[model samples]
Target: MNLSSSLMACLALAPLAQGARLSDRLESAHGRFLDDRRGAFTSLSDPFGVPPLAKIVLEDPRGRFSGPESWHRNVVSTVFWVGELPSENNPTPNTASAWDGNWQANFGGYDHPEKRDGFLPTGFVPALNPFYIALPYNDIGRDGRHRPEASTVIPWFWEDYRGEGISVCKDRWVAIHHEGRVCYAQWEDVGPFETDHFQYVFGKDAPRPNRNQNAGIDLSPAVRDFLGLRSGESVEWRFTHDREVPAGPWRDWSPEPGLPRR
Candidate 1:
């Protein structure tokens, strides 16, 4: 069937999806998604019926889409960390983050962007959760002031804003898909390059062209390992609420105190 027919089937069978896999219900209707990750599927574009992350949004009465704020498909992703040294490929060392002046210290150690011990750094245990990522947009500006566009561009701005000091984007959980695996991570820092591309971050637009293969997001080693991703790979991702995060290795480590857990 086509996309519209598949959607109609989804709504008609919504009750059946309860306490059962939605992917299974939609499989007969759409037959487009085939991934085995948590019964979720991957797609090349939108409205190809609902992927698992979008399933959560559809189930939640409060998270209904008002615009193009669902999954960002086929985005180029790169790897980065708290103390990644400056190099030819990476001009900006991550000694300090856009929000945290002492990112390494706060994170409790060097992330060793490359070294991995099965979803974690080989040398040390991270004081915070190892699963983290960075998007290309920063809500705060270089002038140490919240950007004017942040309030309007970010969907959760009003709901998540604590004050000017805390970032609405920081530590926000995201669900990522690569191959057949889906891994969860937090938004800890910003950039593979640009930091003002909110249009692409929260709106419907492609990533701005950049040197790093137009990387739209940066993943931590833990996220990279869990997703089995190479340095530059295409993946699908979407902002997810803490309550929606599923049980996985991402929760095997500790998150900073007071942060949400699933």
Candidate 2:
């Protein structure tokens, strides 16, 4: 089925998706997604270039259509995710404890090393992103122990697109809205579980629960405090790019994103 068809099936299939495993749903829909992390949608292209209602396209089988798409100001994306953060162990703990020291072995959560210097602002809460969220595995993967870090930033998963989703490395901007509050954050890492859910992350497909948890998105400590988010808190977040981002507490921390960089 095409992207349109998949969306059409969403409302009807949403009920069935509850308590469903990621693999089971994919197998049932005959949906062809890139399972292994060898080569997911890591292209450094303008994800918004592809217009939703356009006619021509060129992408892989699972629908990454690569022609000239549209530039929608407000992308049709609002993910319903349980806010998760990089804590000490698997199935993230309710509150934060000490780093336990193992930063790279088990839940590896690192951000863009290139723009790492000025990533966080002065007196930034949680001190720094506490984990190493590198490639292949964005967030601390499921069933692993992670010793958190203070000077280092913990991973927060994001889309790999410019001007639409993740614009720069850890410098990408995002507006996280929960309850009545709207907080700005950087696109730092990925996955609370099931790392390769591009269809739901980038695309407008309804957000689904992870196999181990229902966490569709994870927030850094700064974001959690600003938004007053408790553990297992529900939130609605979207890719805010550069310009669309408002002038607020998060704007001054790092250099602005969106324009082509050197």
Candidate 3:
């Protein structure tokens, strides 16, 4: 269904401050789904009900995101794009991943650079990976379902949106809102931490173990740089449907078949 005239006006301009607070949006762009006819951000605070979006802070878990071994469930990055690697040392690692692996194809068909001796170049992982987006997912099934594995080589974490009957997708579009900049990126992967935390990502309640780390979302190097997020910085973001996405690197990059919904 189309947005109501008033809502459209609000979306075109700045969202109203009184619109139902989610994270920090003065006004969100919550619309009524044509299928279910349910308002996206319906809140009890709104007498008319249903605000647009929420402006809550997101987490850029770069430093404190720790784990035991390479496969140790908690220390991986959620993305695998090739870029300068960020480490937790006084000096930054002037290095990047040699390979940009595919998530759906099991990291298949990639040009792996030869490792310098047994030692990974300056600041890369043992497998020669410069960096990884540590997500809370372990799902390694080809069927697009959640299974949750712990192998760094498994390349398994993209969950089946349809498995849970949700609409999230790999490489899905998202709008990240910061101090005043609004950067756009694809949902390349899930998490800086806590993958199964559905309520935090989509539902009304905030993400878990938050208030401390306050990590609800993870951004890739590009996304983080675009939004200018500091390590462990908080920002607001919302999922943008395919139809609403604008054309950019996120839209024009390599063709993304994406994970099977069902």
Candidate with best lDDT: 1
Candidate 3 residue-wise lDDT, 177-243, digit = tens: 6768766565544444454554344334555664336565655554555555555666666544444
lDDT by residue (167-222, candidate 1, tens digit) is 88888888998999999998888887788999988888999998889889999888
Deviation of model 3 at 188, angstroms: 2.2
Q: Give residue 177's lDDT in candidate 3 (0 to 100).
A: 62
lDDT of each: 0.78, 0.40, 0.39
Please provide TM-scores, in order, for all candidate models, with all chains considered together.
0.71, 0.39, 0.39
For candidate 1, the 10 contiguous residues with the lowest summed lDDT are 32-41
Global Cα lDDT for candidate 1: 0.78
Error of 2 at 72 (Å): 16
Give candidate 2's error at residue 221 in angstroms: 1.4
Q: Report lDDT (Cα) of residue 23, candidate 2.
A: 60
* Cα RMSD (angstroms) for every candidate in the order listed: 22.2, 25.1, 22.7
Q: Model 1 reaches what TM-score against the true structure?
A: 0.71
Q: What is the lDDT of residue 227 in candidate 1?
A: 87
Worst 10 residues of 2 by lDDT: 70-79
Supply candidate 1's per-residue lDDT for 47. Answer: 37
Among the numbered candidates, top TM-score falls to 1
Question: How does candidate 3 score on lDDT?
Answer: 0.39
